[model samples]
Target chain A: MTETLKKFVAGLELDTRMLGMIGALVILWLSFNMFTDGRFITPRNIFNLSVQTASVAVMATGMVFVIVTRHIDLSVGSLLGLIGMLMGTLQVHILPQFLGLEHPLIWVITIVAGVAVGVIVGAAQGWVIGYLAVPSFIVTLGGLLMYRGAAWWVTTGQTVAPLDSNFRLLGGGAEGTLGEGLSWLVGIIATIAAVVMMVLSRRQKNSHGFKLKPLWAEFTLGGIVIALILGFVTVMNSYPLPKGAVRRIYEARGEEIPQFAVMHGIAIPVVIVFVIAIIMTIIARRTRFGRYVFATGGNPEAAELSGINTKLLTVKVFALMGALTAIAAVIASARLGSVGNDLGTLDELRVIAAAVIGGTALAGGIGTIYGALLGALIMQSLQSGMAMVGVDAPLQSIVVGFVLVLAVYLDIAYRRRAGQ
Target chain B: MTHANAAHPLVEMRDIHVSFGGIKAVDHVSIDVYPGEVVGLLGHNGAGKSTLIKVLSGAYKRDAGEIFINGEKVEIHNPRDARAHNIETIYQTLALADNLDAASNLFLGREITNPLGFVNDDAMEAETRKIMGKLNPNFKKFADPVSALSGGQRQSVAIARAVYFDARILIMDEPTAALGPHETQMVADLIKQLKKAGIGIFLISHDIHDVLDLCDRASVMKNGKLVGTVNVDDVTDDDLLSMIILGKKPGEETITS
Candidate 1:
């Protein structure tokens, strides 16, 4: 028992970005509730916050990869805008003639088309950056302007609106009378993912003839996370809907009525963001490609000597970032039900800030996908809390900017201390 | 004493010449290293010691000459080819990534992977411990990055990597230039251990004391030309200095040393 206790302490001391992010998130939640007279913890407000943060949070996941490799893609925001515009244009102008499909099929095609555009554009930029050895800053900076201009040219500086009903459902859709079911699903999936990851890593270590972490530590952490997720779902489910709020479905005239509900249990954007975050985290942590990413970031010259094709790795990273930007664009456009030239204006700064604040070094080397997501959440929470207190946009911007600078300073300070 | 004649020389270079642009960096220099023997290459800075080693390690291609390993002539046009011939080089800078641990540095370019294809850290750590035990039993490298290690420990890691890869000919450039007394003694012990293992080592140094202590035969160069090779036991530090300064035999009285 004494040895087990000692092992438990060691496990707690392990260096992990996930635990840090969780700690920060808890602090942010408590502070927001304390300062806003408990208004910030409302079910409606929480759901709204999830939807609002999903777009940028998803974008930052890809941005983490680019930043870790000591490269920047200033073109991400513009790529998002261009992808959104392409989806909108295809749904409005080309879907009818391109295919006779309707509803769900057309929605699927539009999303795929958006993703394709993102991939093509990303590959073009990656080729220049990797093959020509052009500085990523210059290539991506040029891409930022060019892609934004392309978006404007595609739409002629006009907003495309009145998206098909099916497309709208993708952003804010309802599935049945299972209120809070989707949120519960997300919570369960995340907990399961966390548990599976821990088990697989342990197994991998043991198979490779390495020491394994104490079983109790792993189980205790996993159990606590699962319990917390269940508790969150219960709290969210218990909140009573405001009086006269529209029900999602109503039985009338011997037919079902699709009521426009604000909380459709879970926002599609939130689910999309969570799923993407999980996938990216797996890819970055558990694969050979992930090792190459870390190696390239840590020391490019050493990586080259180690026989890693550093150029291919760099270009692939950029391409992956592009794909992520497109996923974010899809979620954004689906939520807004329209796309315009200014869809992703100034979003590049937020994405980069999210990665930096999450502890990804701007100098290239160490980072985690979860860190970027947590960084985005911290930004989102600050923005949402300030808005709840009736703070102006400019003031909120200034506060976030200060937080970003503070996070970077803290990162540098931590590294310096570690160096010593 | 007769072992040097009984066993074939580990490495031999014939009329090795390397030039950059129009100037010859290493002009017609020839040297040989016998198994289990230390050979010192003495020269001033820019006097072609480094250039000659670079050609042997295939870091630089020779404009002319042939290299033989164990009496079999071979072409080493690149570092990979040099490794194929069991020739390893320890450069002045060490070329080690400071952030990596000793084990990672040991198998930097080539790592042991498990069935899952991830780097097998445990296997590597175990192998590192085993190798350190044999090479430098006093080395304590557990969980420490090379950056945090002492200068002697870092050198141990570099030498261990070369030796672990089965290098028959070890080329060390200025191995003890920056070491203190104690650290220098540690490296000297390591050199004796390598000599016992029957591994031929090329010790390049400007310190006459190190050459006299560790080398069996000392070869001096002046202006990219070989002066002569002398058995370390038969020559004095003054004799080696005369060869370097005047490019002549010791006791000719032409150069003051």
Candidate 2:
């Protein structure tokens, strides 16, 4: 009876760990708001924070899988750095001289090469771990140093500057993925899609004779999510920078500005992360490949005896990690607008912290994409908040460290209390 | 009673040899199991019975051996190869992924999927329910991970997995060792049902009483080699024990228990 009540209160059925992490994120946000005297919770700051969290959040999503399979990759930071520098060279120097800056083929080739390099690097590492029988720790640890060295070697420790304008926009510029009206349209469409999916899934579960949330509970969830989406659109629409092109003309004429809103929508990288999260969630929840991954992580001996190719799974996981690292590289480079020797310095620690904080088991066989993203958000929020409050960098690190430990400790205690 | 199956054993393992780091785990042991027959492998600990059966289940590669199934020579290289031959083993450990639910464990490698390859979880769960209904009617918690289940219940899930996959040759390592008396009876009935369906079973057990109650033929092994295989009706439990303990055939020595 108590369990049913609690489930009803939650409105949406989710693992308590996921709920707790989300709750922690909320608490973290509120505390930051209090610390910064309401300056931190503004739509602009939240928007910026979301964009900034994209790189680590994206990598954290993939890291959840790697860690779930009872393996670790310490080379992501270096891989990100190397991929960023390689893209930088191609976009700013190599391609411009050959194909010219405005040529459409240049961006296409550079982007394709970037993804190819990531896959090849990942596949090679995966092959070594899966087929050649090298332990992932030793393999990726070697990758850490080798890739970092390669990053330095690529441009001889020089910073590659002024990436393409199109690429620049993806890193979170004044321009947006969608205009103001289109943003509202997408938001409404997404909310409708969510409701439709809920209905279909509920029908499927009912057909399977599974107990389901009551109609009121379902309605409450749909209402909350739709409200949140519309709210987010409202906030983005209020950013008010590129006001209809007429505002810019009026300003040029030294005339009074008209009271109108022009929206830049959400950042492209943020949208990319959203799409990636959706695809990953479906894969994790609905696909055979995903089931095999969890099974292999849960028990390698059982998985192998059940005819799952565990060694090959290990390799594929690393390859996917590499592919995601390359994607992160694109975002990081675009955001920085310059590729430095230390492009992704010490970033592996951040995503590892995020993944674990989101309740991914160090012991393996458990993780979620949303959990890791929320974990990333919490981490970035603390950093961004502390910086806004003029906290010393060293002190911020100490606080962040304590927060990560505290979050994980609380999660462990909760699981124990719940007898998980 | 079928003359067709009496012509040849469903499975024949000849002179199986497996070594782990120069230690002969299974050495020159041979066994044959006929269809619709329960062949009890009786041995003390370290007698290489489990190791010997593992070679047929494809968990371990025999250094020297030729396995013939259904009157044809076939190579058993890995678990996948063994599965292709419809051979399944229910290990003493149950070999379940504890984090996955019973249905997931039941369909670990072979999952039902839609056109896009997304697993049809509903179909899998329904199938699991149908099979578990036959194997263990009292089973209720289909969504709970195998780790959360009791020893007997876990055994049911493992058995359901084997039977659902259409396995013709079943190898069970101490299937009733951890089960209670009531649960053990359930397995006994299940064995009878499988026998009725003409499935061949290799029941590896240290329980002499169980062997007497269930086995049609008893093969005793000692020190990685087979002592002898005898008809259960032709010998007493004491004779089987002597074969197990003294590595002698039944007629050679009898304890007269």
Candidate 3:
């Protein structure tokens, strides 16, 4: 037990950002419950918070890459709005006749179109920054205004609403009883596959004459991850929308079991956010491209002298950021069942702040996708919990702004101390 | 002193003149190096010994001069041209990125890539180890970044890089400036190894002891002008210092002698 305690402390120390964020989260939760008379801790509120945070967190993952390169994308919010508008326009005007596509296929086409637009815009900005040697602040600042104007022009300053039911299913719909069971099965299989991969990688490293972490370290980390997943499943099962709640649909249908029975199972948006987080983490940690990103951030001149095409790497990072912004835009539009010129207004600051708070250095060379996700969660929770406590929207914004400043100050202090 | 082709100089610079911002940094200087020879370039802080080597390394464009490599006039306008002409310079700053490993520094700006278009780490490591073995076998920095390496080890890596790329003419600026006695010896041994390989070296230094110990010929400069090149065997440290300080050969001028 003493050894286990020591190991846990060591792990927590290794993950300073996560531990700090978790502490902040706990504090925020307590304050929220105290102010809301415990309503903030309700299952319904938690589910709503998760849904709302997903879009920003997804966007924040990409923002981390840009920030790590010591660059800023002030235009992410405007770009997201523009992409969302474009997606809505495609669905309304182009999807049915131009492609002869049905519901789900049309959604896919819309997403692809959005992402393509994002990539083009990102590439254009990246080219200017990388080749022309324009400051990212100026380039992305120009992008902010330009894309916002384009979004307004595309949508005619109006909201596009009444999306197809299939499209709505992506954001608002929950899994059916059978679907929940299937998701649980898929989740278990994925966990197993991940474990196998980790074991294989460890073995490969061992064979290659590299030092492997102690078996206990590896097993403890793996076990904790599995435990978290199981805990999540347990919480989901206990919710009112559990698979067991699907009996209500059968009762209404006057049948022993309803064929279309649905519970308030995990929403697609939640699943999407989780999957995107996982994939982004993998991409950041496991790929050569990811290593290049870190290397470029660490010392661009050194990287260049090492024969790394830093210009291309910068362009690729921005392009990836754009693609992620588009994905976030789609999710936001789907959740709202509409798209508007104001869809992502001021979200850029929030995402950047989240990344910063999560320990992404303003000076570049240090950051992680997981840190950005946690940062987004902290920001989103503040907003959601404040709302539950009857705080006005503008006040909530002020609070979030103050927290962002505090987080940045804390980060600076930590960095200085670490240096000493 | 008795090496083969010692009569035929490997590199000859005639009336080399270089200026920076209208100031004559190297004015009417000439020097030569024979195969397997170490030519020490001596000067005060601004006496233009470095400027002359910069011209040779193609880091600076000479205003008026001609450089002959093996009796053929060569125009070197850039580092690439210098490399093509087998001229390599190891500056006082070393020019090795500290964050990179020895292998990466060895292949910086020209990495060997694999068939899949990624840097060939194994090949680079093998080449680095092999070359380092010849230069400084005691240098145990195989994978560690150059930043962590000692001054002598860093110099070893820089020298290995130049030699590995087939540099026939090597220019070293203050190679042992900051090194201790042992480290300086390590570099001196490496320089001897280079001479044995038939690579002509330009050893730039202010240390007369180093010049006497390592150089086959000592060339002193004063106020952007060549004093004279003397066989190291024939000159003393005080003679070289007099040439540097008084702007005249030690015995050739009555005032100095």
Q: State TM-scores per candidate.
A: 0.80, 0.95, 0.76
DockQ of 1: 0.22
Where model 3 places Cα greater than 4 Å from the true spot, the runs are A1-8, A11-13, A30-43, A100-104, A164-179, A208-210, A237-266, A270-288, B1-257
Q: How do the residues A1-420 of candidate 3 rate in per-residue lDDT, one tens digit apiece? A: 999887776753356657778889889988898888988776567667777887888889888889877799999999999998888888876787766545568887787788999899999899899888899999999999999999999868988876644566566444322245755775687689779977876775565455567777788778877886766555454456545546655565687865653435456777787888888776765445665666667667545533467788889989989998988888888888888778899999988988888888877767888788788888988988887778898898788889999998987887677551
Query: What do the candidate models score in CA lDDT, each in turn?
Result: 0.78, 0.87, 0.79
Order candidates by DockQ, high to low: 2, 1, 3
Name the 10 consecutive residues with the lowest summed lDDT in model 2 chain B: B248-257
**Higher-ranked by lDDT: 1 or 2:** 2
Predicted structure with the largest TM-score when compared to the true one: 2
- Residue by residue across A1-420, what tens digits does model 2's lDDT show? 999888677756657677777777788789888988998888788778988999999999989999999988899999999999999999999988987885777656767888889888988888898889888889999999999999999999999998887777678767635657877888989998999999998899899887788888788888888998899888876665655554764676699877766556777888888888888888788998899889988888999999888888887888888888998998899898899999998999998998998888888988889899989998999899889989999999999999988888887898788766
Better of 1 and 2 by TM-score: 2
Q: Model 2: how far is A330 from its true place, Å?
A: 0.5
lDDT computed for candidate 2: 0.87
Name the better of 1 and 3 by DockQ.
1
What stretches of model 2 exceed 4 Å from their correct place?
A: A1-7, A10-12, A242-259, B1-5, B253-257
Best by DockQ: 2
Q: Which lDDT tens digits does candidate 3 get at residues B1-257? A: 64464655789999999888888888788899988889999999998988899888876789998999998888988666787888877877776766457887787656677566656555677778777877777977676767678877888787777778888999999989978888788789888988999899999998999999999999988878888889999977888888888877856765321
Off by over 4 Å in 1: A1-11, A16-24, A101-127, A162-193, A196-216, A228-279, A282-285, A418-420, B1-41, B45-91, B133-146, B168-171, B177-202, B216-235, B242-257
